[model samples]
Target: MNEADVFTMLRDTILAVLIASGPVLALALIVGLVIAFFQALTQIQEMTLTFVPKIVAIFLGIVASLPFIYATLTGLSDRVFDLIGRGGP
Candidate 1:
């Protein structure tokens, strides 16, 4: 592939990854921030307190967003395959 093709592929790959993971990452960030705020308000500085809720929230987010994520990945894969089939540069 040429330089432009390589860059385009790389950019597409990164974008696909971000789209796939965005929901879970965003949920984790929100949960972490909320937990941190709660901890600050209560003066309860427990490490595990942050971990469990974030994990649960992320897990729930993944479950909830599974269909959207699947569709995005499938689309990306189809496009990549189409490129390959077309002998893309």
Candidate 2:
């Protein structure tokens, strides 16, 4: 691939990654903020309290989001493969 083609491919890959990960990442951020707020208010300050909820929230987010993520990744892969099949330079 030429420089421009390479750049476009890289950009597309990064966009796919961000789109696929966005939900879980946003959930993790929100969970962390909530946990921080709770710790500040109740002074629980438990390590597991901080970690467990974030982990669970992220897992749930991932589970809920799997279909969309899979579809997005599959679409990207299909496009990449199509380009290759078309004799991409």
TM-score list, all predictions: 0.93, 0.95
Model 2 residue 7 distance off true place after TM-score fit, in angstroms: 0.7
Tens digits of per-residue lDDT for model 2 on 20-67? Answer: 999899999999998999899998878989888888898899999999
- Local accuracy of candidate 1 as per-residue lDDT tens digits, 1-89: 68899789889989999999998998899899999999999999999999998988888899999999999889888988998999995
All models: lDDT? 0.91, 0.92
Best by TM-score: 2
How many pairs in model 2 have backbone atoms within 3 A of each other, for residues 3 or more apart or on separate chains, i.e. clashes?
1
Clashing pairs in 1: none
* Residue 25's lDDT in candidate 1: 93
